[model samples]
Target: MCFVAAVVWSLWSAWHLPSWDRQMDLHVYIGAVRAVGDGVPLYEYVAENGDPFTYPPFALAVFQPLGWMSEPVARLVWLGATPVAVVSIAAALTTRRGIVGRRRQVTLTLVAAAVLMVSAPIQSNLRFGQVSVFLVLLAFVDALDLTPRPVRGVLIGVASAIKLTPLLFVPYLWVTGRRRDAMRAGASFAACTGLAHVMWPAASTTFWTDAIFSTSRIGNLAANGNQSLNGALIRVGVVPPERAAAWLVLSALVCAVALVGARQCHREGHTARGVVVVGCATVVASPVSWTHHQVWPVLAGLLLMAGPRRTRMAWGVVLLVAMTFSVGGWLPAGFARENVRLLAALAVCTWGLAPLRHRAPATVGLLPGVRLVVRPRTAMAYAGVVAVAAGAVMLLVRESPVAVRFETPDHRDEALWGAPTNGCEGYTSTLRADGTVGYACESAVDPVGGRQLNFGGGRGGSSGMVTIQGQVGPEVARLVFVPVEGTKALDVPLLPQPGPGSAPLRAPEHGRPEMITSGPIEDRRLPGARGFSIAATSTDHALLLAYGRDGRLISSGGEKLRMG
Candidate 1:
């Protein structure tokens, strides 16, 4: 019942909500598919949302069938697939040897799927129409299946072909003694690449030669949403030169520990736990693991809870994983958010590292049919592998070119307009790089009765309010805006757009413009006002400035602004 309810709610939300806010990523996929069908260059074409095609060319072929359908139908199909994928993964995980009784397994699958559907990551996946859930399902099924080597390899290979991250599982399979499966996975990946080349040779060349290495095409790596170790380091002021080496060392360590733990679990007949451990490692080691990619830890949490012992520690691990998605923001910024996810993943690995105890014949009903067997050679083998892999990675990082500093691209013409300030409250308008404008405003008198304004025009215009355009120069931009209901419009100029190299303009104090260190200047001067001033502390900051009738600063108020 809960699962049904969740699915119903997801479907309803997908259908009723505005297209711009939800299923946006799905629209990208659909656009990519349509581009392929229309013989358009994949990497060059932007989607409706101004995002370029980021997925591999092979993924286009996979989603190409959807191009034939109408957009609404395709969206419905995509949204509907998420719940099915979640349920399928849950079913696959629960159908294993230790989970006794069909009814109990089904119940657990339904409950877990329902709970996960409402979780933050899954909700984010649905909201953005992302393919992370499908990727998770593919990976989990490939890892847990006791099927023949080729089948598992094909699943992992296909997933990796769609998105590069699943390639991590190939090494994992090899380390776990699934060498044949690893070879097959490589072959399958090669086959997919060959197919892509055959299908779209030009796109294949462009993607493989250029687009694949350009990580900036995705977005800002240090943004808060990026939960990877690299992102965390960058957020805490780690320079790019040191960040690459640091990431290599940290990722190598995580990979070694996770693989060793997984091998130990598998040797001890805990295959499910082993798979989950490797999955957790994949997310942690990736260079850009977004929050939606956290489906692995969620799956690992469910698997841990299903274990026979169900100890306080097991439940605690599950709770920690849950908290990663729930109250993650409560922790301080930088490493704190990344640490929450990392710690949960480490806890899952630790669970796998626990010594397995042999079950008596009577107690075999609770455990899997296999007995707990210890093998020291397997440990030594993994230890040797870890040593070699870590050495290779460190060597590569040391020899690789110096990491390039990342810079935010200048969007000088981009001016965000706030709604007409009516007694200290108004709406904010954002101008996207693609020249699209979005406006949302709320009135001070009636907070609930805010109006959303619509403004049109490309990147060029004049100074007057009648034009409602933006005149952006290298240092300053003049933005003219008209009220939603009123005829009068206002021109607000912002000096020096926000970026690394822009100079800061200080707020006027005592009829003088106080110069400050470099930063963006927010000029909120109106036609007639008493005075204005800007104040800044190490942490807290505020700005207040007034203009005279002749556009000269007559008076100033508020605290003096400080520059760091």
Candidate 2:
């Protein structure tokens, strides 16, 4: 079943071949590798797309062979290799103890790989042709191996040399009473770094001395795609100036707690579970963990599934995985973007660490009138149950009633409604019958003078005592306003009008006002009296906001206006 699923997935992925060249991060890696091979100074070269090579110099060496191949061929090879790496990791995790048969081992490995491919993190990794899968496999093998300490350490060292995040595992080794392995891993890491320095002194110097700490090179740390605790706090309205200190304190606390849990798991003969927990903690504690860095949670889920049955931890893992797989349009934009997955990872770490009693073993029939104690049927059963539950939840969320609906204004309409409130407060929009929309947003000041609006998943938000107006056109609504106080008013187009019955409109192209073609106004029931609602996408970003007859600002779902 696993092999069949993997083959189908691979064929489908191959059918979408045009996207191979569009893997931005893979291009960055390829560029660095070519630069290294050509002796053109790796750190000094930037790709045409404005992305800099941010990985360690040794990573260039690791990927150097790809530079020799044509771009298409390299991409195909990389794509194919990812599934192999995923399968390898699964094999190591599932077959290490040698209790399972060879056929069962292969089936389990393929099944694990297939399930992971559906997750958002793995999807993102494959989309970008990232090395995350290979790195994950290396770390998993090192952490779960019962071999000599040096071999385990070497695997982790090689992984760390390619990407700095895996360095977190070295300390994990020490904390879990594997001091020799930790020391060997540290030495191996140093040796690789030293080798890189020898091969490309200039790039090595620049990376170690500056690039390693330059978060800007990696793009916006506070971007919605960054799922770290720091990113979450930033999304929740934490100011930039204090966000670093806040992240430091919070990351420390999370690490301390997670380490304690991981240590417990390690001592309890669940090394794989411990390693997975540590991996999750590392991602959560990092300053900027992209969506692809979240593979650890999936690993934890698999571990729980293959562990003892009828336990709370097992059920919790099932629910967590199910929730993650079910995540989609039903969630608030911000929550859907990153928070939900991050929360799942945190939950896995926490649950894995908790001290829960194991359930009694179940007996299964091996022969006539003969029963043998064994674990729950297999991870496949757990996956099947979760898949069914997730499908049901998705159906319900999709068919649920609209949260808010707007009423179309007749000739003249005047109503006041609060802003679509989420994470921020104190802003309102008013729709006038004169084909005009007015906003009376409170100034970004209360006790402290700063913006209070935390537009989590939206393109952005505005603050301060500001008054802005826009004329609603026959086909498009042009919103003109300055984002900050004392700035000139900028004209921006609203989304194309949506159809009736509260149906969602397709996202409009950015900066293309001509593309803002109008559609029939949705005739949805309002909370109060009859009024028309105009649903439109935000021009600045892929955001959906609706304005109703009153001052109703409806986001993903409509909200009842509170008349003041």
Among these predictions, the greatest lDDT belongs to 1
* Alpha-carbon runs more than 4 Å astray in model 2: 14-17, 37-40, 96-98, 146-149, 311-328, 332-338, 353-564
Model 2: per-residue Cα lDDT over 105-149, one tens digit each? 777778777777766677677778888878888887887765565
What alpha-carbon RMSD in Å does predicted model 1 have with respect to the real structure?
Answer: 16.2
Over all chains combined, what TM-score does candidate 2 have?
0.61
What are the models' TM-scores?
0.63, 0.61
lDDT of 1 at 243: 57
